[model samples]
Target: MELKDVDLNLLLVFHQLLMERRVSVVAEKLGLSQPAVSNALKRLRLLLGDELFQRTSKGMEPTPYANQLAEPIAYALSTIHSSLNDKQSFDPLTSNRKFTLGVTDIGEIYFLPRLMVLLATVAPNVTISSVRNTAVNLRDEMETGHVDLAIGLLPQLKAGFFQRRLFHQQYVCMFRAGHALDKAEMTVDEFCAADHVVVVAAGTGHADMDATIERKGIKRKVKLTVPHYVAVGHIIGSTDMITSVPERFARACVQPFKLRYVPHPVVRTPIDINVFWHAKYHRDPGNQWLRSLIFEHFSDQADAAA
Candidate 1:
């Protein structure tokens, strides 16, 4: 189909459907009647010659064709919106922008509290939402504008993505303050023999700490495997199990619960946490302001720690 023959507004409707995954919700978001949204979806399907979405128990799942169209449609819409608003300045103080971020449980522990405080003081109208970072298709999620930013040790990032290193954190061995192992500095042998709680998120590989131990020809026995770091702390507190966590998080956990950090016997490779965004947003004024704010907040944190 020719570009002139298709309604450009249909693309906007298609984008909303892709993001919300439900026609009724998309209609509510766009302030259009449900029938209007359904009509637009039908037009989009005809123009694209594909059933863009298939009804699923969870929601409307995107077809392969719809997935392929997501990025270019989002880019086009963003470009059009930016061009139309070229004369208007982005006033963060008055603007209510919702930013969705993909972050790991460890990131939520180390960064969210301070970040929220900063936002409260500077951009009170801005809102933030965070989802777990899995070892899945993050590049697609970023490119399609599903997630505004991702914060973590992303091992493999695709091209055309911009990344800024936030900070490097080392792992520390943590145990209850009066635990038997807390009497001395933790040795690799002792760490491997201790009953451990391993935290593993979906799609993320098996525990990096365990992998490090295995490389030393020692096997670390995991007494339990939990989905998030938040649960790991609770389990460690109630039981005699030890867990290796990022130093910043371990420090925070040590304060409330009677916990102590013993130096990790294995070589601790500092995990580099970085913020990543699509290159298309690199020079956008709103995006630039948000990125700067994140860096400033994290920089202050590093200084305080030092």
Candidate 2:
């Protein structure tokens, strides 16, 4: 089809239909009457030469052709919408935007509380969702707009992605208050020999603390392995087990759980916490505003902590 002959508005209707999977819902989302949306669907079917959607008991289901066209069509509509909506300034206080962020448990503990406080003050209408960062297809997720931003110690991120250093975190040893280990600083042998609770997420390897210990030609005994760091504090508070985690996280977790923190004899290597996004969104105005807000919040927090 020639570009001049094609009605681009039909693509918007097609995208809404694919997203909602129901004509009625798509019509409501686009603020168009059902018959108007149906007419647009008919035009899309003729333009694409395929039945884009078929009625089923589950609702409107996309045909194979529609499935193939979904991403490209949605991406095109997004680009056009962004271009037309590009303004010199963004009023976050009045905007109701939802941002999806990819972050690790450590980040959720160390950064999100302060970030939320900042958002509450600056953009109360803005919503935030945090997804777990595991060993998965991060590059594809960011490229396809599945996630708006990722925060973690991402070492092997793909090229063409933007990464900004948020802060460097160091390791600390955590145990229940009044525990024997908390009486004094922990030696390497004591740290290795202590009954330890290891936190490992699904699809992720051993914890970073383990890797740091291994490099010193010493091996630590992992008495238990759990999926999240939140669980480690619970187990450590009840048992004689100790865990090594980021100092910021340890500080946050200890006060609530009545736990104590001790300095480890081993040299603490700093973990780089970074904010990553696709290069496609590098120039997007809304995205730029959000990124600036995150940096400002974290920078202020770091300065206060120092």
Q: For model 2, what is the error of residue 103's alpha carbon versus the real structure, in angstroms, after optimal superposition?
A: 0.8
Candidate 2 lands at a TM-score of: 0.67
Where does candidate 2 stray beyond 4 Å? 1-89, 201-206, 304-306
Candidate 1 local lDDT, residue 263: 68
lDDT of 1 by residue, 9-75 (tens): 8998999999999989999999999999989988888877899999998788999989999999999
Candidate 2 residue lDDT tens string, 1-306: 798877887888888888888889988898999999999999888887999899998878999999999898888888998999977566898978888888787778877898888889899998888887784477788888878888877765659799887777777889999888887688888987888887865443226667667788877788998778767778888899998777778878877789998776674777777788899888777678888787766753656666
TM values, all candidates:
0.67, 0.67
Alpha carbon lDDT of each predicted model: 0.81, 0.80
Candidate 1 positional error at 218, Å:
1.3
Best by lDDT: 1
Worst ten in a row by lDDT for model 2 = 200-209
- Per-candidate total of colliding backbone pairs: 0, 0
Q: How much lDDT does candidate 1 score?
A: 0.81
